[model samples]
Target: MATSRGGSNLHWRNSNPATDSIRGGSAQRGIRGGRGSRGGRGGRGGGNASTPKRDPPPEPDIVAHPLGELLQTIRISDLSLEAIKTSKPTDITDLKYVASYNWMEGDAPTIMIPGKPPAWTPLKQPLRLKEDAGTYFRDPNGAQYPRYPAEPAVQAILNSNPTFPTSEIDIFACGSTMGNLLRFVRASSKAFRFSVEVVGKTVFFVRKENSPKEVIENIHGFGHSFPEAYTTWEEDTKGSSSHQRIVQYNFGGLVCVMRFECDGYLRDGTNQVDQKLSSSATSDENDNIIVQALKNTSVSHVFSTTDESLSIKTGGNEVHQQSIFDLKTRSGKYKRDIDMSDFLPVLWLKQIPNFIIAYHDGAGLFRDIRVQDIRNDLRVWGQEHKDDIQQLAVLLNKITKIATEDTRGLLEVYCAGHDLEVRRQHGDGVHSLPHSLRAEWEGMSDEAEESDDSLGATNGHGRSNFSYGDEDENDSSDEDKDFTACSADTCGYCGTCSY
Candidate 1:
């Protein structure tokens, strides 16, 4: 007989379900084992049937590269001046990695390249660098940089100097007004020499340095004095057209003026000067005579005034007067009336020679004269007015200083933006000519030299080159001879020309 098994242990076969069920039933009926025995076997089988677990595979080791780790450890603060100065190995090549670190130093650190000295170094005792207060900087090659990095220095110097007084009169009140005022003052002081001539009603101002003969030849009438004469019935009916005629004279060989008239309409439509029949004909004849006079006299100055006058009425009658006269009357009856109408036309004249004092009444004397002139006049009146001139000069100096400072600052900013190297030259001051003019002169000299060189190369053996030094020497000798020939006590030349 075979051993008996419980129904729980029976296994079904895939091929005949009916046959398996019948076999399972028979096996169950034949089994003699109790529930407790089955239970005990099931527990023992469960304990031994469990699958064993294995440990997880070891994780891959994580190792960082030395260079990468070093880079990661670097910080901007580590690139300080002290760190740079005391860097290990001293060799720049070896410490290139250290230099790679971001730097957070004030201004850009002077990078130390191989074989190059740094601009700045860490002081043994840390200290702030002070800025230079000079207008110029000396470079290694002795070159000059103007209004560059040293603008602050230039400004400091200007500030330290005496300031101009601007309160009494604004030198820059009008375009080119300051320059004009300076010119007038210099002329008045005899610093600039000129000649003035009066011919009839016209006055002429000519520079002493210029050839008077040339000016006389060039003088000619221009623009119509009264354009309305062409169309106005009054002028046509009177058979006279108002016009200006410029004449040249032989005496002194300068320009001459014929007749200067100060006549216009009054508010009530009356002429300033009465036009009597005899006076009118005489005036016409005089105009023609002036044209003829140019043949005999050399006029050096011309005067005319275009400024309008305010109408004045006294005792129910309109009084026609000149603006200059009106101003004088208003100032005081004691004040002399200045006839500046003749002086006002000078401003319009072209080709002004050097040292000439031309007056233009278009720009009235009261409006154009410098404060210094007024002060001078006051002094002439009395000695108590000396302080006024000094005060005015102070104001002018202050304004000039401020302008110079602003100009310097602007130049510095421009140079910095362009990353240009700045250099300084010695002895730059107001007494010297402007830098732009000096530069132009230098450029012209260089061009002249170049042209001479090219000519020399082309000529080779054809011609002898003139010596500039010899020419300059000859000119100086001539000037000396002229000076010795003239007697200081009794000069044949005019006072202006004698100088």
Candidate 2:
């Protein structure tokens, strides 16, 4: 039954103190009865003794100790804070049975030591207790014998599902220490974690089965720029008869490599796709120059042996270098027809010994271009030389421009399939350098395991062991101030809304 709370509940007619006082009632009190004693109560309790009024308990003035000290106390003293922290306190009296409880298992064993100033040690081996006839007792309600007995059915279910399981996160570190540090920071960063879901060491990449309309947009979004190159004709040679050798033209130009490492995870059980999270480093072209150089052979492989002549060294020595570009097709051949766009070449461009620009064609396939390497060198060469590498980068930029502009068209061409041939424009020659000249290495790539996640693409996992601290040790704070959060509408930030 519903009752009307309108007329009688009206303050003017029922509880209006001002009008009541004017009408010969006692002096008016505030709505809360705080101003005078006319109303019933004040604050939490009123003066009426039989009304069963309650008084608030005094709040404890809490002093928190450092985590280490608290942990020591928890281990040494048998004093447990678990009861105080929880609304429902636990009774420690029956803790002897704790060994049988799954919740008792943890990273470190709880050890209680007694002394004037107590000390403790985590047990290397867990304790186990067996119940004998003397230890047996009736159930709390006397409905069953032996207060606690294992339920075989429930135990079976738990065993099948591995209930309350614990896992250890293992790290495999490789690459430069600096790279590893950035990766760790990126994984642990508030901004990166909150915006997207990422498992600690697991990474996933999503490349469209077919090229997207904004494939170039996607690449740039991942923080990479195009490279410049000079116009060159791909030479072709053919002759059924030794007397006649015909030459044909193929494609040639600027080369670039765009390498991106993102912290990500699978969205579904099938792992059909992945959601991209934050990048390990700030979105800067120069950030992964060393990483790109390692992964992209075209960018540096041809000049694999550090040439003293080309290398800038203080004592004049050859700087040996290696690349991340692993071999898939040792001979660089594909059984099925594949397009250049789909073939992301670990190959990139570098200055050749004879002053000629060179690149590891990855068997000279046009589709396998490395974008990041191109962008890194282009920026440096564009800044310093203004004449050589920059000019070449600008020329090569056209290829990417075309690829990006017509992503769908190029993707179609790729799906249809294509082939490239090799021909010699001139005979290879050798150049000698003075002993005083030598090349120096910037970084090294160690063995690493990359996982195949989705879209037939490989995502880098494991840990890297590189030191970025050396690069900005003096001005570490500067690194924090350099990049602002992305302003993209869908961008995920950990806490603050402002990008």
Candidate 3:
């Protein structure tokens, strides 16, 4: 995601004369002259002094018609004048009317008029509303009510629990519509958090949360999909089968590999009080005991295989899985007994950590001249623990096999420990071997010759007139040394011979 800065500024101005006339000029003048004539007089007069005043600027015309006269005849009264007062409170109070004739309550004259009452008719049945019910209505008293039939009564509750031939039932619902039903069941039960329902039968196992503890099965094979779900065992045990009891879990963003050892048998070699495993357990309970065991086990290590680069969480820190293996290399805790070489390809894709490269140098196999500062803390650790070099060599050979072409070539140069003509065949072939490796090898060779000369002098005790060899012979010895150096360069380590 590269971001760019600086851009050309674009300025826009309205060029339409109609828009300009509507905004800045008089509407009446613009209407009379039309759009093209607003600045016509000024522009033409400046160009031609002899141009006339354009027919006396055309007089403003006002032609009166019958509608105008009718509008003039209409009158509007002025209520503000004192002579035009229309409202009188005094006249209203004094107003009275005398009755021309008096009449009693029933003496009023009655006139008969012919009329007929509405004919009797049969009432029609009310219309039936739709299933969703008609719109509700509000009564005059402000209470709102639905205009639908009364709701049906609820079904009677079951007095006894439902039973089946098997303790656990497998229910299979087909079609896309079943998704909603399965989701409903999943949402209704908190105990079925890890339950998965496919298109086929979904076996529902009934297991007690506090069921008797059982042994957890060991995970086998690489590239196994993560478990659908797992449980944690509170108690731990020991022996060869103890590795099987170990679980991997994601804790605090790191992959933790914890074994179910006697409660205090820590992988770090610390000890604590051991928890005893139950001995007198019955075997004829049910198949749910196995399900409960799985539900009760905890993860021992946390790892994510989703990405090409596998990451393991350890010691509360998230790091590459290769780093975890490197740590195991130092601690000698890799009890799984799997060949480390088998995972080199996986690590190569993930990029090998620098510390692992340094470990090879510290093991006193040819120094891994590829890594920067190969003599760091990890290298020193590797030097102190040389017993693991054989395993480390296997991993190194696997890495060399899977490394990029350029990396393989660099490893070859590092192993050769001197510049070779064959290296110049690739990119930057003109460049010499790394100065550090070259200098180190030169110093080692010089020290070796010095030690040899000192040993000879010590062995030739009491000899007086000892003469050194001639210059020509010395040149021959130097040539012999160069030949030996060339022979050593051919010794393959990274599986690539520089010739």
Candidate 4:
């Protein structure tokens, strides 16, 4: 895309009424009296007059990235709030008491969806109470509580154990009612793809391929309706759950697509671990094994591969491996941390492997971009170990394929919002979305889809094959009602809703 338009020369508009209104005026007043000279002399009013002009406020610096896009996705219409009270009074004590009574009784209340993604799920709604729950009634406290019907099917899934089958589950409770409905489909026993609209917002359980045709075709095949309901947000008791907290999925904010790519094995030649792989070594050997693992396993099986050259010899006594594929011309690298802490608080972190897909209505096309920087330290290690070249190649291939698949998946979910344009640039190499990602624009017209024009103009000297088609579905308008933030027609610009 072309750079932003530059500012033009400033031209202040002068508005001096005195010059136009004070045309040649006679010394005499226009008033007519019985006697011509009886009128009092009209005083000549003349003074320099000019309206003072103040400078406009400075524009905020444009720090562009996936974070800004994510923040923009958050809207206040999605939050549901309630009021609470402990005591019941013969007469209404105050507005808080009246509000609490009304809310507890299921009165109309407005929902507020913030523009910021919550750190956890089921974001708490702020409600003020007239009295504490304890003060309502002494013996059998008359305290009121906020309530909603139980989603039985989802509740059942939540009550299960580790190997929960989400095949038909809506675990997110996000439905057509939301902006975009994410349908996560397990393509293989070990790999899955969260499907949505054919635009953006999909997450692949594992990486797949980098071909444009493959990406588009995979997404275009998803069914229209959402699947069954899954688990609801629950507080863990054992403190052993994967998530620190859980909140309801709100469709209003930015839709992100994440994919995992694994290299086959480490390529470092320092150790003779290769002979051991072909030997009678147990699965335990492969558990923490880095470079040598790539040779034996199929590239399609592993999520990410580490390069032998990507190791650091600290103090000349030990070797440390890293998971990053470094590029000479591209702008950055990829991330591969498996631990919850490194990737946890998934919303934060600078080098997490995830793409922030956003739709700018004014622009008429969805933009795909990565949110964080991939680790460079680990990638450098991969480039240094060369003897294990085949393993390194396998690892690179797998990572590239998975990242591309994730880009495609997210575009599908964002289909409800706007048309997608996969940006690619020559020389920018692997870092550009077009080079590293693939996309499918759902429901695009044959003429638009066939034309090379679909590929948006290039920037920084690189070109892309991104397809530009239609805007999002019709917008739903809702101006009144509290408990609900938007009218039933639309989900308040969450991009997840269609009807």
Q: Give the winner by lDDT.
A: 1
lDDT of 3 by residue, 445-480 (tens): 334434555534321111121211232342232224
Residue 283's lDDT in candidate 3: 38
Q: How many backbone clashes does candidate 1 have?
A: 26
Write the residue-wise lDDT of candidate 2 on 267-385 in tens digits: 11231112222245343332233224323311100101111111110111111111111111111122232222111211112110011111212222122211111223323432443
After superposing candidate 3, which stretches have Cα over 4 Å from the reference?
A: 1-266, 271-273, 283-291, 295-340, 344-499
Residue 161 of candidate 3: its Cα lDDT?
15
Q: In candidate 1, which residue ranges exceed 4 Å CA deviation?
A: 1-271, 275-298, 301-499
Worst 10 residues of 2 by lDDT: 237-246
Error of 4 at 109 (Å): 17
Each model's lDDT comes to: 0.18, 0.16, 0.17, 0.17
Name the top TM-score candidate: 1
In order of TM-score, best first, we have 1, 4, 3, 2
User: Per-candidate TM vs. native?
Assistant: 0.16, 0.13, 0.14, 0.16
Model 1 lDDT-worst window of ten: 37-46
lDDT of 3: 0.17
Deviation in angstroms for 311 in model 2?
A: 33
